[model samples]
Target: MSRFEEELKRDKFVCSECSRCKKIVWPPSNYCNKCLNETTWREISRKGKLVEYSYNKGECFGIVEFESQIRIVGTVKGSERPDVGQIMNLEKCDYDGDEIFIFSSTVQRNGSQNS
Candidate 1:
């Protein structure tokens, strides 16, 4: 198995498709924030498009998400080289022994972005 797949399986992190509307309600919810219907856990591609982003200008801040109806946020990782509208894939990371997803990323060379 690939490293990503191995890590996912080891961590037992289910994607939880949750809803078709594509909104991530942290702490998870029984119903999707947009669709408001029952959701099922599914493995999401560890890749996604960076719709919006900002920098702390050298100051470290807590995780923050974009204003898009569906938001994605997590601990800022690496050198903060990503810019708004960049597409990237998740890298293996851990927070206090808890596996953290998507350490850092940049725009894919192909220019294709995923939601």
Candidate 2:
């Protein structure tokens, strides 16, 4: 498995950052997509913002954006409905042939419960 997949299996969210240009490499790679330099792995922040969302069979799913760059689709876990653009925290992650991400909202950065 790739480093990214391995990290996911351990419930750690990580991405490759270019050592030369310091750019975050999405679709995590060993080389920078911009500068073609070798990359080092780094943990991504747990906090993200909800970008968009949908429901399937009453399960909430949404696209969450992190570091103003990386965007990932994950299942949103909560009893109440989630608001768009609300702050979200990565709750769980794993890999099993495919990646799995789970998120839950705590509070907005501005201290509001929802946004």
Candidate 3:
């Protein structure tokens, strides 16, 4: 398994924090792209918001942003259109013996009012 994928399966959502600038790097890497400095792994929340999305040929993909501004492009699992700021949950998915990450919409607040 790739390092990032392996880490995701073990650690849930993670980001590489640059020791210098403290920039959160998504798609975790060994080195920080911003400062070329060594990065330390930081665990981020599994739930985030869907910022953008697209669907084609029954395939869905979108960008999700976590609490720390950690964003990643992942396959969205549901049919609902992704709206900006829509809450989503990221989780590990097993496919073809490989672990993949996917996002799904979380339950929204029911606005039903008692009459």
Candidate 4:
């Protein structure tokens, strides 16, 4: 399995960063997409901003942007309605043939309610 998938199986969110250019490589690669330099794996922050969301069959799903760049789609978990630009916290992550990410609403750093 790829390193990314392996880490996901362990519930650790990680991505590649360019060793030379200090750039975060999305889609996690061994080499940087920009400079083609070697990449190092690094854990990602759990908090992110909700970019968009939708409900399918009463289940909430959203696209969250992390570190201002890494965007991922995941299931939104919580009873409260989620809003765009709300802070989201990664609640769970796993891999079972397919990647799985679960997130929930969170308060902003300024102590403001997000959801």
Clashes of each: 2, 0, 0, 0
Regions of candidate 3 where Cα sits further than 4 Å from its true position: 93-99, 108-115
* Candidate 4 global CA lDDT score: 0.92
Q: What TM-score does each of the candidates earn?
A: 0.49, 0.89, 0.71, 0.90
- Decreasing TM-score order of the candidates: 4, 2, 3, 1
RMSD of each: 6.8, 3.0, 4.2, 3.0
> How much is the lDDT of residue 26 in candidate 4?
90
- Give the winner by lDDT: 1 or 2: 2
Candidate 3 residues 31-53, lDDT tens each? 88888999987777788888888
Candidate 4 lDDT over 1-115, as tens digits, reads 8999999999999999999998889999988999999999999999999999999999999999999988999999987789899889999999999999999877554786734
Would you list the clashing residue pairs of candidate 2?
Answer: none
- Summing lDDT over every window of 10 consecutive residues in candidate 1, give the lowest-scoring window: 60-69
| Residue pairs in collision within model 4 | none
**lDDT agreement with native, every candidate:** 0.50, 0.92, 0.74, 0.92
What does candidate 2's lDDT look like per residue over 36-88, in tens digits? 99999999998999999999999999999999989999999987889999889
Q: In model 2, what is the error at residue 63, expressed in angstroms?
A: 0.5
Enumerate residue pairs that collide in model 1: 16-41, 16-42
